[model samples]
Target chain A: MTLILTALAATVTIVFRFAKQKTAEKLRLGLLALMYSGAALMWTVDGFAAMFAGEPFVELQNPSVVADDAFLGICVLFLGAAIWAVGLIFKKATKKAV
Target chain B: MACFVVPAAEAVVVAIVKKRADKAAKLQAEALACGGANAQTNTEQKARTKTHSGEKISISKKLGWLNAMLWGGTALLFLEHVWHGEVVFWPPFLTAAANPADTAAMLYEIATSGVAMAVLVTLVWAGMAIAADNISWVKAALCKQKEGANQ
Candidate 1:
């Protein structure tokens, strides 16, 4: 599920944020952590809401459905990375302009 | 439901604030330029403001970090909802709006899950901004200790 993927990404980013000093800060690892963790939080809330609505929080689905969910999750992951990349590019461009 | 809208809305507000801050910065820079230059003092002030990383970022820049997080998260969640057919390109947009019962449920989701996401992201960003600003202090202390050791 998307939740699990984002949560894992958040965990890894947070660890990198704290463990590495120079490279992590240069890469803005904290922003990446924020993106992933925010998605994970949103998904967590969605899961709880679904459960309250009498739906399974997460369930095994048809293979196609599962595949679609997996694909969507990957896309979400890439989207977050893309946003971070754009931010970095913007920052670099602004620095150059200055 | 349309849970992503909450953060998207917040992003809009933050964007306006950033714009105002940027305009103010620009005007201040212009004023500094117009005034007769105190080159030596200006250099001294710049040096005093410099962080270990070389520049002390402004409040606006800190807001930028939060804006990016909110916008990025909102986009991702919106995409996921669209993938599941909860959102559509048609009028009303939300699939849940077709039925009254579903509409109520969607509203509930927005009230709880949507608001929670916005609040949580903002809280995290607050913590991040505090840490980012304090990093200068921490690094400066360490540098001083290193200089002491050298002496």
Candidate 2:
């Protein structure tokens, strides 16, 4: 499920943030963690709802759906990284202007 | 289905809060500056000014970080829902709006999932603020910025 991957990404980001506080903070690692965690939280709700409805939380039998979710997980990861990068550039530009 | 709406709504509230916080920070800075004007020695005045303005980041700026997180994540989730056909460009916006039964389910999802996500995001932001407040590097950055300002 996308939730699984995004949650993993969030954990890794948080770990790396602690591992290198100075560089990681400059990269806005917390923002990336927030982004992944939001998606993970939503997907977690979806997972629970699915289980309550007598449906599997993840359709392992359906390779296509699994693949789709994996792709989406990667996309979300890249998108979050992109947003953080842009924010960094913008902050730098503003500091220069100031 | 409509889960993204909760965080999206929260983002609007956060933006407004950020605005007010910015104003408050500015006013506080001004008051500090005025108060420091009466300091006895030049060095004392400089120290007072540095300490006042040397905060690593303004409260409003930290709020802006939270806003960015909420808005960015919500926007992406909205697009994902749209891609899955859960959301639409129509009047009610959610595809579940067409059916009474499905609409109730959607409302349940919003109440549970949406509220949870929003709360979790806020909690994470609070944790981030607390962590940054304690981190030595963050303080060093604040001092460096103050040095730059003084120069």
Candidate 3:
């Protein structure tokens, strides 16, 4: 799950750099990437430490919690990315018309 | 985090505007130069003129405020953390340990990370402002080159 989130975040970050409209798309995608990667890194490191040390991870007992957190994180990331992408496309179209 | 984003965006916007203003200033200078104005005299006069003019006033003034706010807010947040200790909603598990040495390490890490992020964000903002200020010259040079080609 951590790896998934990290990958998603990194993907979004890369996409952000290439989508050059210099609009909100950049911010939305960049922030989404940062948030997802940050959360993923935080959770993955913590989760791994707990698993390796034979200790109970904070959200380990709640299988739903892990899924829920990851879901929410991904949702935010994707939503932000989509919004940014749409905005960029719209901006480009407008610029072309002008 | 949101606080940081606002300032960063503001910085970027300021930078863009500054670049535009710089381009305008440079074009004006080039136009003057093409008309046989003295290089040094025109530059000094342009500088004096800009100091009095309001062309780039918006960017400079807005960015100045943003810079102050970002740095000030970051400092206040850091001081708040120092006074109250780690104030994050979810303290990391390692930091939750009761051992004094472990706790100290965690606190140090948190403090260092916070400071580093704040500094990094502030620097980004500063760089944006500087870029905004200089971008005008870049744009002016490009425009002038284009114009020369047309001629």
Q: lDDT: which candidate is best?
A: 1
What are the per-residue Cα lDDT tens digits for candidate 2 across B20-95?
9988877866667676656425546666665555544557767976887688778668767877899989877889
lDDT of 3 by residue, A1-98 (tens): 43455456656564653444243233434334443343343334444555666875445457886676566545544544554467568867897999
Q: Of 1 and 3, which scores higher on TM-score?
A: 1
Error of 1 at B116 (Å): 1.5
Poorest 10 consecutive residues of model 1 chain A by lDDT?
Answer: A17-26
Higher-ranked by DockQ: 1 or 3: 1
Q: Where does candidate 1 clash, by residue pair? A: none
Per-model TM-score of chain A alone? 0.93, 0.90, 0.45
Candidate 1, residues B69-149, lDDT tens digits: the string is 788788889899898899999978999999999999888878888898888888888886766556775445433433333
Error of model 2, residue B135, in angstroms:
8.8
DockQ of 3: 0.09
In model 3, which regions exceed 4 Å deviation? A1-7, A11-61, B1-116, B120-151
Collision pairs in model 2: none
Instruction: Provide the overall lDDT of each model, using Cα atoms, as 2-decimal numbers.
Output: 0.78, 0.76, 0.46
Q: What's the distance in Å from true for residue A94, model 3? A: 2.6
- In model 2, how well does chain A match by TM-score? 0.90
What is the alpha-carbon interface RMSD for each candidate?
Answer: 3.6, 3.2, 10.6
